[model samples]
Target: MSKAAFTSDSLESTFLAYTRVLSQYREYWDFLPFAQFDSGWSEPKVAHAMAQLTETDIEHFERDATALYQQMVVLFPEVKMLPVPELRTQTRPEVPFWLHTGIGGRKLTQIQAFVATLPTHATHSPQHENVLEWCAGKGYLGRFLAFTRNSCVTSVEIEARLCEQGLAAAQKFSLSQRFLRANVLSESATIPFSMNDRAVALHACGGLHTTLMTESVAHAIQAVHIAPCCYHLHGEGQYRPMSHVGRANDLGLSREALKFSVQGMVTGGDRIARLRQQELSWRLSYDSWRQVHTKDHLYRPLPSAPKSLFQGDFATFAQWAAQQHGLTIADTEQWQPYLAQGHKLSVQVRRIELIRHVFRRVLETWLVLDRALYLHEAGYKVQVELFCDYQVTPRNMMIHAHYLS
Candidate 1:
């Protein structure tokens, strides 16, 4: 294998360096509900812009403000960016006509994207007798691999309904792709990987993928390709580091901080942005009202509400939110300041996020680098890269590990 683009030492150094910076500003970004504006954390221009910001500026803030992201630029001049599409290392096998017909446009795109990454992914290791698919929703990739590579595929999925569907599809094609309905997270879920096996997980969420890696090492899976998604999911309230180096690091990321790693969005359009802004602002406002009544300064995360809740004015949303938590909503005039403070806080929060945004890829890369390091420790040569463009999928990064004897 060619030299890895970033070695374990380099990835950890970048991670530890940025982790140091993030910890330095942890108090500013964490506890968003009560993150007071501190002039010390923000530079003069940043502080000034934050003060000038109002709800109206949400639409056109970037036009008037050029230096908002300047601090990030200065701090991380050589930061490794993400979302670069993976190289076409292996020429794609001709897809059967029927393979392209049944799927919807989005699913079709995802399948094709997964196909494009496989050739490059396949090049990293020796061929195996079978493929072990993890979190194999509908077994799309397994079906394709079994067809193209002529290897039996053992697909593992949590949902029986999806397993039935995927099994039916594999039967239709007469392909040797079989599904096992078992939660990859459960100890009872046996993923039968052997020396002759190569494992692939398209986009396993959080610890489900971690479980796969841990099990792959335990079972001595010869080759593996994994694309990880949803860094915040099923981490037992915080990230359980996958590698010894990661475990030893002083930077301890809470679930909230881990959520911040994936907060950078590419496909979310203006409408989604506005809705998010409104939800956050209203939550801050609700916190203010709740604080005044209960005298509790601690942050309470709100449950996900229907989109319709955010479709109305801040007051309407605030009233609904107040009722949800049994807070007695005072009359309109008294609640205005809290609502306004919420909007103001949203601006400051976004501004503070500007600094954190610089470290988004760094943190994400660190997580995956940890995975790669785990594989390395397990005696596999690992390589990490973007498997698809962010437009095809924001969850584009893939960690490929192959047992090299």
Candidate 2:
């Protein structure tokens, strides 16, 4: 199809075509099931491991944690701790007034540090400024750019609430920023053109980032900076290989791996304990539900709603659901007191932690490679580095790019 005729449907069709092409070139995409990781470990073995690893066994726990960390390193040798330079020395007072505000201060500090890493260049002319902020929820970064750089910022978002919220925030902050409510996936939502303009997206999701990359190149955006997240949520309904090496090889990237990438990008090591508990809960719930319902063995598909029903106490939820769905309640009266006491809360946290580790490694690899390839394709000088160590925050990696031409 001609580029102009490539509407949303056409774009989606093209994407599917590309997926087929990619499949033809690669073996794993065709042979392996997408939900292979969901099979999980044997329930008995998992239960045994959980029972053996009690909170009182601190020494054993420590050893296990250390071993897990080592395993993580082995699984993702490319994952590096981001270097955290002292912000006090690096932050400049005269940078911008907004830089002193709440989260803005931290963001500004990070932005300045990121800028320092990029090849220096004079800001593009301000006369015809048009900046696009991809996945700009509440226009935080866009507002900063508009106020400090004196540019007209267009914050594109999928949710109407976020667009409204962003516009309100811009008004409250007294910044010249506008929020455009549109799905990035929609072909009608094309990037506006201005010869000297720049595009910026922070933590844009997988397919959304790819859209930005395509938009930037198609529109010939003069400058762009992006930090991507949610690598598993790509256009083909799966993670697309970002590097030639990944494309050629079949490395098992689980759904948990995708979730970990999101966790690493957003949460830091501080939430490790909580994450572990979460993972345990998920495992229990999944296994318990499977045991109770013999026919429907598969985990429910990703719900088409705002929140997950699996967020609360699983046993309690299961009991409630049993009545709602007209299913016989399994007799486990001995476990009722423990369920009532919410002892499984800790397990929930552990489950999240374990799953996050799996997802983080897979997602991080995709994210790093995506940025690297996007920059390379755009003919811009780019460097990827850890913005902060995984201990401080998992989302510490920064993709710094500068237009050399």
Candidate 3:
């Protein structure tokens, strides 16, 4: 297979067909026991009971999702006005600058330690010992691999600053590695590189991993180890199904379906982090609001902002958010009273965790299927298994593949 032979449309169509088939597995949607309610809630049971009592029950449940769409539109009418911060900015300093900062140093060291434990394999062919790191951010993994395996590495990155930082690190360590700054999205820019080398990508987000798969197969790269993350960031702005398996059989996948598929990748651990951050933010906001108002009132929902903004100081953030929402804060002393409201935060966290637990299996299934399809397309013998059994690392599933051709 060559770059000239790989068609993006063909890959997109194949993925759309796979998702349509996957949607039909009613068993996949089975309801788990809800501890709060004495009786459990089951979708099939509810559908069956409704059908027994009314002639239109089954039809209503099976109806096209038109009503659901209308309800969503009404609830979020000003969707076009929603503020989404641009993630890629030329003005924003590259991650390497932060790496030298205390917090960044700790993060980089932690990542290096983690990568050290990941398993490695012999060069695909004993004669060709080079390795290619796809979307290699700061080339951390590439440096580690080169040091551990005593092999030369060529790391590809789109950001020039990242490439420079990686090169600096390589020089510091005196490692046999080189960094190339180029957009992986352009096949011509990336594919002509040394084709016989092994390839690896650890948690390469979205389309970056997909390009690796396409390129690896086209070049007949000997071996590849990839762990994909952020499935929703493709050129299509949604998950284009990669396999023709399951409910993806008949339906043409929509952008919304792709979004749902991406959301489905969030694991129990990820949800806990989200829940904790949400609870902490809410607690801080409520405290700030209560200081200005003496009345004991129920808390209202907080307005939404990009996830990155949530990392800042809560009190300062509240003040900034208040101006945006057209609200005024009069008193700052009653903050203690709102901080005393512990029950709400506890209940919300518990509820969110329970919901996450119920959805865990489905998310894992989607992750496995996506990796399996990528390996299958690459003509590899693939095995999917739990990389770790501990609940703390449930997302430790690994897709191991060996070349079949």
- TM-scores of all predicted structures: 0.80, 0.58, 0.53
lDDT: the better of candidates 1 and 3? 1
Taking the tens digit of each residue's C-alpha lDDT, what string does model 2 give over 1-405? Answer: 111221212322333343333333222122222233332334444334445555544223333443554443332222223221121223222455654355554565555444443333334554746678888877777776676566788888889998997887788877778887888878534545443367777778777877777677666676777766666677444555554434444344455445545643223353554454443344445434544465764433222221244455555555654554456656763444434333354433343244234333334534464445555556655555554334433454555455556
lDDT of 1 by residue, 1-405 (tens): 122455434555544655565565454445443354443554565456455655455344332222333434444334433222234443445787897556776655666666665544332235545888888988988888777677688998989999999999999999889999887777434657673368888878887888888888888788888888878895576677778877887466778767876765322577887787778788888887788778887656677788888897767777777788877676744767888887777677666655555555557767777788788888887767776555566677787787766
User: Candidates' lDDT values, in order?
Assistant: 0.68, 0.51, 0.50
Candidate 3 segments whose C-alpha is farther than 4 A from its true place: 1-40, 43-128, 191-194, 246-302, 305-353, 386-395
Q: What is the lDDT of residue 37 in candidate 1?
A: 40
Which numbered prediction scores highest in TM-score against the true structure? 1
State the lDDT of candidate 3 residue by residue for 238-313, as single tens digits. 3455554423442343443344433432234645556554555454455446534545444444556655555655
> CA lDDT of 114 in candidate 2?
41
Clashes of each: 0, 29, 16
